[model samples]
Structures are given as C-alpha cells and as structure tokens.
Target: MCRWAADLGDAIFLEDVIAAPSHSLIAQSSHAREAKSPTNADGFGVAWYGDRPEPGLYRDILPAWSDSNLRSLGRQIKSGLFLAHVRASTGGATSRLNCHPFTSGRWSFMHNGQIGGFEKIRRRLENALSDDLFDQLEGATDSELLFRLMIGEGLSSDPYGAVSRVTSRVIEASRVAGIEPSLKLTAAFSDGEALHAVRYATDDHAPTLYTAAFAKRAGRCVVSEPFDRDGRIWREIPQSSFVTMTRDGTSIRPFAPATTRWALAS
Candidate 1:
C-alpha cells in the first residue's frame, strides 16, 4: 500500500504538509506508521491547483525522502489544494508514469490501496472505459484506471455515486474470476472546486484514512494518518465512509455500492 496527504484549505506552501510536519508525507516515505508496509520508496508525486484550468503535477521515480528537488519545489509552490503521495508498488513497474496524483484536466486523484487480482481484471476494467477516458490514461496502474473509470461513469456530475459504481464493478469482476474480493481502497481526489475521499473495501479491512478540520478556516485535510500525534487535531475516518471537503466546510457520510443486484445480474 501507499501513503498520501491531501490539503484543501488556505493557500499555503506545499511544504507544510509534504515535508514540514514531524511525520510528513516525505517522512512517511521512509517510516510509515499506519501502512501495511513501512517503506514506500518506489516513487512520489505532488499535484496542486493553480490559476490554470488544470492542476500542476510533479512526479518522479525517486523516493520522496531522497529527492532534494522535491523539498525545494515544495517550499516554493503555494496552493489552496494540494495532494502528495509516496508509493510502495504492489504491482506495476517503478516509473514516473506509475506515480500517484494522476491527473485529467482539472481533476487529480491519489489512492492508498490495491485491487485484488488486478492483473486478471485489468483488461475488463480497461474495456469498460470510454474511448475518451481510455485515451487520457498514460500509465498502467490500477489506481489511474480507477480514476478514469469514475469519469466514464459520470464523476463530474455525481462524484460519490460514480466511485460507488466503479468499486461495485471491481468487486463483481473479481468474484466472477474466482479471485477473493480483497479490494482495499482509501482514495482522495479533487475536481478543483471540491475534494472527495472514500475509505472502503470489499470487506472490513480497508486501509487507514483520516481527516482534520481546521479550527479557524473553512477547510479540511484528508490523509492516510495524522502528520502529528494530535488526537484532537485529526479524526480517523470510519470504515465504509465517504467525505467531501469544499470551500464551505466538510461532511462525512456512510458509503455503499450503488449498483443493485438486478443491474449486475442483467
């Protein structure tokens, strides 16, 4: 699994979350406290929205802790919304193309879990994407595919429902292939105006996720774990839940697959 941090708040330097905290994303790259694996050294990526229609992205195959360039860039860039990820590949080659914070137009996404038997279901998932979405894909990771699949399923109109439909498809496909449904997904994404995150799995063993609401600002942060050990500052998101953070505030609610058995059986 991987570790990631997403901040949707005041326009501050990216380094505040990516490298400044005592247990920042850069620190998690070397010694993660909550992931199944301790070292997420395969690569790292950061994305933040700016004045352009699309978000700016910086990704590399170097481990976050070892990359001085990342530290320098983090200190310089400022944005109201930023996402940073440290990867520990369960599948796919260790390349920049395989890094996190995958982007499409104004949307950026990052994931902290793996789909069970992704290799078996990769073709099925790819075939389900629209031609336009398929063309947008530049990497071979299931994480990126999930993002495009959500877009094909109407993410721009209904972000939460689109993700539910995509996860339902992954679960159903794994079952048909005789693979144990072990889809551990805790993902965060943004469409420039708002951020959406989900902590869910086929079973109860979802990867860890947390969120912190700023006391003074109308903003919230979604992260794999609290950057610091302040229980008062962060709330561990419940299993099988969804979160949305916007300029107004933050909201949390239960989440379930939207696809019905009739639809799957048909």
Candidate 2:
C-alpha cells in the first residue's frame, strides 16, 4: 500500500499540504505511520489544478524523502485543488511512468490499494477497456489500469457510477481467478472541480481514510491518514463509504459494490 493526500478549497502553496505538516506526505515517504510498511520509497507524484482545464503534474522515480525537486515544487507551486502520493510498490516496477495521480484530459486519480491476483486477472480487465482508453494507458500498474477501467465505464460523466461498476467488475474477475479478498482501496480523484473518494474492500477490512476541515486554514482535505495527531483536526471516513468534497462542504454516503453489481445485473 501507499499514502496520499487530496485538498480542495482556497488556493494555497502545495508545501502547506505536502511538506509542512507534522506527518506530511514528504515525511511519509520514509516513515509512514499508517500504512502496512513504514517506508514507501518506490516513487512519488503530485497533481494540481490551477486556471487551466488540465492539471499540472510532477512525478519522479526517486524516493520522496531524497528528492530535492519534490521539495522545491512543494514550496513554489500553489493550487486550489491538488493530490499527492507516495508509492510503495505492491507489484509493479518502480518508474516515473508508474507514479500515482494518473491523468487524462481533465481528470486526475490516485489510489492506495491493490487489485488482488492482478496478474491472473490483468488481461481480463485490460481487455474490457475501450480501445481509446486502453491505448491511453502508459503504465503497467493495476492502479493505472483501474483508472482506465473507470474511464471505460463512463468516468467522464459519472464518477460514482463508473467506480461502482469498476469495483464490481474487479471483484467478479478476482472471484473467477479464485483469489480471496479481491481488492482493497481508498482512492481519490478530481475533475478540476469537485473531488470524489471511496473506501472499500472485498471483505470487512478497508484501508484507512480521513478528511479534515481546517476552519482557520487552507480548507478541507482528504488523506490516507491524519496529518497531525490533533483529533480536532480530522474525522475518519467510515469503511465502505463514498465521500464528496467541494468548496461548499463535504458529504459521505454508504458505498456497497454489491448494490452496484445487482443494479448492473438487472
């Protein structure tokens, strides 16, 4: 698994979210407190939306703790919405192209989870993608593949529904391959406007996810873990739920892929 953060609201420098906190994304690169492993040194990436329809992206194959470029960018770049991720390779090769916050025309996505038995079901999932989306794939990681799968299922117009379908399909594929605990995910994405996130798993255990609203700070953010130990600064997003955030506020609702699957079947 990996660690990530997403922020939306008043414009602010990226450093405020990625590097300045008590347990910032940069610090998590080498000493993540919540993930299964303490070190997520595979790679890292950041995507931020400004005035442009498409977001600006910066990624490197270096460990985030040792990357001077990452620090420099964090301190200099600012945005109203952004996402940063520190990778801990589940199975994919460690490379810049494989970094998180994968982007398309106007959408950016990042995930902290794994597609169980990915190698066994990889071809099935890839084959389900539309030619255009499949062709757009630039990395070999399941995370990227999952992004494209969402696109294929209509992410451009319906993120929640698209993701629900993708999750159901992933679980079905995993079952066919006889893999237990088909998936684990706590993922976030934005379309240069509002942000949508989900926390779900094939079984009862889901990766940790949380959202914080700083009444006196930059705004609201969703993260893999609370940046500070201050309980007042954050709230845990319940397992098997979908959260949506905009400048106005944040809301979360129950999420169940089985409901989505049943809908698809009928």
RMSD for all candidates, in order, please.
2.0, 2.6
TM-score of each: 0.95, 0.95
Q: What is the C-alpha lDDT of each candidate?
A: 0.89, 0.88
Clashes of 2: 0
Candidate no. 2 TM-score: 0.95
The segments of candidate 2 whose C-alpha lies over 4 angstroms from its true place after superposition are 229-232, 258-266
Give candidate 2's root-mean-square deviation (CA, Å). 2.6
Task: Output the worst ten-in-a-row residue range by lDDT, candidate 2.
Answer: 257-266
lDDT of 2 by residue, 142-260 (tens): 99999998888898898888888889888877766667647898999999999999999887688899998886664799999887765436789999999999889999998877444
lDDT string for model 1 (134-162, tens) is 89998889999999999998899999999
